[model samples]
Structures are given as structure tokens and as C-alpha cells.
Target: MDRRKFLSATGLGAVALGAASTSVGAAPKTAAPAAKGGPAKFKLGCQSAPFDDEHFAFFARYGVRNCSSSAKILDPGRIYPTVDELKTLTDMGDRHGVSVDMVDSVLLTSSHIDREKNPAIMLAQDPQRDRDIEAFQTLIRNCAAAGIPAVKYNMSILGVLRSGKVKGRGDSEYLAWNLAEAKPPTPLTRAGVVDADRFWERITYFLDRVAPVAKEYKVKIACHPQDPGVPPSGYQGVDRVLGTIDGLKKFITINENPYHGLNFCQGTVSEDLRDPGTEIFDVIRYFGNRKKIFNVHFRNIKGHRDNFAEVFPDEGDVNFLEAIKVYKEVGYDGMLMPDHVPEVPGKPEARLENFAFAYGYIRGLIQAADHLA
Candidate 1:
């Protein structure tokens, strides 16, 4: 991202900027051929976690057009969202001119494994998991009935792991993970000793049940990858099978349904690589080309592999501007939203400020990339 400023100083940025403006302003009839998903249509989106009028208003103020919602309808009290409840979410979005493109709550999130809603689904437990899968399938059908195209969820026993937080850049605290500093408890999670083989068995069991339901309902199921993969020797007696690109490749092929894809958290993926700045674009291209990327958790990291800090997009190891270009290259047509914004000192307002910066920056990058090539 800093390189863009350097390019500006050298006049290259000006030239590209001008070319971009002209192309963007040109008639649509002059456009070039697009990839399988068709010409890239990058929309700025957000988690809108609460999905209340306040968050919806915030999105509208920033011109956000699409979002992954955690609307009240999907609250934990409810096992499956009623079509009317979901419509209420859309109606709320409609009032703010935002489309509720995706929802989470069905499979819960990447929260602690013990607190996860569908524990049986990940534990590979039968009778109970069957009920869980049935509810999930209903959620997929409900998404179709409600016109929400995707549902982002997590399937992890450990959830997101971190060593600690460190302060930086105007006193903002960064979420960090250094495996060397971690002292995972001996008992691990309640899931106990889930090896790679056992983990895959659990993952496939859930996918086998729900992939067809997703396909039938025409709802995309976006599974998030494990955050910051550790060494295979095992982390606290558990093996994370979905923490690597190879595992992810295997994942999409399991049920082999077009509706099955990823939520593509780039920062987490970078943590699994030796050199994220050099390696991420190829990864993006791989998924984007296959249309396996349904949504993106667009944030950056300051380091690679087992040790890294989740940082602002501009100062991370990966060049997000270049990454945006590659996303354009792959013809990705989905919400590219910020996921892990660091904690700046402004209390709740600081969080909003960080999100504002990320959303605005991403929107600008998308516009610039669209015009560049």
C-alpha cells in the first residue's frame, strides 16, 4: 500500500490514476472480456455484527452496499431463522440501501469450541449431530427462501487462537499470536485429542450432510479456515486439518458442490505461509479462478507463519493494493470486508473509526484496481 504513495511521488500513480478514471468513466460497451464470474464487481461490505439500525445506518453513511449480517433473527436463542424474521433483516437493510448478502449464526462462528452451537456437528456425534445438521439444512433452505445468497460459518474445535496483544501506532493494540509464547492446556478443548484424520472425518461428516442441501437451495456455504495454523506435531493435542491451503483445496472437493466454498480470511491464510507478501496472490488466484471464493475477510498481518500481528491493511506484510489487483484478476464478485481491526484508544468509537478507515481504503482500492486493467 505504501508503494502506491511512492508510485504517486514518481508520477506512475498519476498515470495509472488517470487511466483508471478514464476507463471507469468510459461506456460499459467498451469493457473487455471477464473471467467466469464475469467482469469483476467488487462491492465494499462489512460484518455489521449487530445488524441493528445503528450499524445499518453506519453502513449507509459509508455507502456500503452488501454485508455479512449477524442480525437478531440469527441470534443464539433461535435454532433456525424464520423466513419472516430474515425478511425483517432485509427490510432493515433495505431502509439503509444495503443488501444482506450473508449471515452467520447457523453454524455459529469461530468462537470457542466448547461454546459452539452445533458441537455434535464438529464432534462427529450422531443422533445429536443429525438434529444439528437438519437445523443447518433448514437454515440453508431459509436463506434461499429469504434470498440471502450465502451463509458464512466456522468448523473448528479450537476457534481463533492468540498469544496476546501488543500496543502500536498511536496506542492501538494489535491482536497477535506467537506459538513460542503459547502454553496450550494439556486437556486441550472438550473435543479432546482430535488428530488430522479424526478432524477430517468430522469435517466430512458435516459436509456430506449439508452440501447437497446448500446445492438444492442455491445457497452458498462459506466455511472459514482455521486462524494461524501451528506445527503439525499438534497444538494442545489437536490437529487443525483446515489450517493449510492444501487442506482447503481438499475441502472444496469433498462434496464438490458449486455452493460449497470459502469465506477466505486472507490474514489467517497468510499466517500459514512462510512469506505472505510473496505467496498470497498465488493463493488468491487459485481460489478465485476456480470460483471457490464466495466471500473474503480482507485484513492483513505483520508477520508470517506461527508468529504475526493482525495489523491495518496499509502496514501489513502483504501489499493489499497488489492483492486487490489479483482479486480483480480472478474476477471475484463478492464482499471484501475488514475482519480484524486493531484496538485503538477511542473506546467503541475507535473501533468504528478503524472500520471507517478500512472500508474507505478498500473501496478506493477496488475502484483503482477496476480501472487499472
Candidate 2:
């Protein structure tokens, strides 16, 4: 269906949850408990980098109840942490009152994969494939032992690539990426230009090996989508998979284990479709209704595909209220964290300011949607 028709059918224009007028004046006030009822339908969370007591405290002050720690905190040198180390990190979360819902951006380094010359070789049938698989299994086991329910990761050899910046509110700098104006970097592996089929085959092999292990550990593997949208076939000397809906569906279908699911990055999926409203909502319902969404990166952008700027939750193209409504409709009870908020300029507490703004904005939306429902 056309974008306009889809918007009309989905009642996008009818959404009344406009931007909140109240400025985030100070550190967030402690949220009051729900009135004599069951638990909240969904929880608010954030991905704090350099995850530490200070960061957890900051989030807690803003009423965040769950968090995903930066992968670096778990494995500083990209070597997987031991079970004791993982438990220590979880203990830190308990002290701060924020549950560590997941570990963000877990990856196997070139050294662990044992393919320093071209780590992408590990993505295919390489001599070091066994080593790479073992590294991932160990990481998953340790995370599960430490009480982490999910692990978010990327399967692509090339991670997120952005080209430029855009001005946001208060002249804050937000990162932007335009594939049309960007040059593709050279392929990283000796086995260059792996086709889509080859990529799928290799991913299937990896999942086949890891899916059983994940089920055994009772931990979900949340596969993140390719960022900045996949380039046109062969545009970047590679057939980019997992950047489209079809690619994502294939990824999920390849492994039937309930433990294999999506990280459900709203912004990246919207960028791939190049429509942040209707298309984004459809994808949300598609995966969320099926319970394939393990977690969510709840952020928004001003544009789509290569030409986009991450903005405040309400200021972006996606109608977050409607998005939250869909999540409720689908019964998605997992963590939904604000990802990629632009820095507010000049404030000594710029990160805190941005995060507080996002947290308040999302919290308001969630409440409004639930009340309306």
C-alpha cells in the first residue's frame, strides 16, 4: 500500500498525543506508583555507556527502571567476561535499583575470532569459524549465569556508518548519514563481496549452533538490524542483508527457537523503509504481535534512509504515542529504552539533560497511550 493510504488506515493523523509543553526543568521527580493495580504494562529503560554507578544513578533519578549496559563494560578488551565478572556488573545494577535488562552491542573481536587479517572471514566458512562460535557461546553462557535475560548484537561485518551531522534544537549536533553522498569503504575481509545468499547461509550456520545453546541458557539473542539502511545491491561491494523487512523475516525464520528474535530498533527499521510513520508502525505490529521483539530501541529521527537526524522523541517523524499504543495492543512487555538522543549544547550536564528530556517525553507518551487505551 502507498504511504498515504497506510497512514490514513492506521489513524496516524488522528493521534492526539502532541508534544508535551512542560520543559524538563530539573532532575526528574520520583514517579508515583500505579494506583492499586497490577505491574506496568511496559517498562522504560536507557542504554548508558561506560555503565557505572554514576550512570545508573542518573537514570534512576529520572525514573528509569531498567538498563542495557555498554558492551565495553562487560568485556573491556572484547574478551568475554567470566561468570564472576558478569555477576559483579549485575550486582552494581541491583545497588542502584535499575535492573540490567540486557547487554548492548556484544561482539566477537578479530582476536577472539582468530582472524586478525580479515575478521569478516569468520562470517563465512573460514578456518576460524569454530573459534568465533565458541567465543559467542561463552559470552552467552556467562551473561545467562549472571542473570541477564537478553544479549543485543549485530551480525554484519560493517557496523553503523554515518556521514555527516545536522543541527537539532538549541543548535545541538546530531549525527546524519546520506548514502547517496557517501563513499562505501573498502571490504574488510579476504572473502570480499559475500552475496546475500552466502550471508544468509553463514548466519543460519551460526544460529543453528547458537540457538540450542541460547535455549539451554534461557537467554534471548536479539539481532539488531543493519544501520543507515542497506546500500543498493553491489553499491558497497556487498549484498547487504538484514537491512530490509524481508531480510529480517528470513533471519527469524531460519531459526525457530523462541530464544532467537529481534532487537527491534525502531529508527533503523524506519530508515530502511524510509517512512517513519506508517511503515514503522506496520513493522512494529508484524514483529511485536508475534512476540519476536525481544526488546526495543525507542528513538526517532527527522528523516529516513541516508538523510536523517536523530531528534527528541516527540519532535521526530514517528508518532511515539501511536507506536506505544501498538506495543500495548501487541502485549509487548519488554524493555523500551531511549537510544541515540542528541547532546544539548552548553549544559555541563548535556548528557543528563538530553536523557532527562527523552525519558520524560517517553514516559508521558506511555502514560497517555495507556490511559487512552
Which one is best on TM-score? Answer: 1
Give lDDT tens digits, candidate 1, residues 1-373. Answer: 3434423432322221100011111222212233223345778999956778888999988878899886465465668888888899999999999999998855646877777866788877879888888888888888899999999988888889998876656768888877776777555778888888998988888889899999988999999998867666668677777888778888999999899999999988887776677777778877888999999999998766776778898888788877887788777889999988988755877888889999998988877776674
Record all residue pairs in model 1 with backbone atoms less than 3 Å apart, i.e. clashing: none
Q: What would the per-residue lDDT of candidate 2 be over residues 1-373, giving only the tens digit for each residue?
A: 3334433543333433211111212322222122223334788888767688888888889889888775444445555667787777788889999898887533532131323433642356566676667778887898887888988777765557676665566657776665655665554334466677777787888899988898899999888877755554643455557777767877888767889899888877876654555566667767876788998889887666545666677777787777777777677888888887787556646877788888988888767756662
Best by lDDT: 1
lDDT of 2 at 247: 75
TM-score of each: 0.88, 0.82
What local lDDT does model 1 show for residue 150? 93
Residue pairs in clash, model 2: none
TM-score of predicted structure 2: 0.82
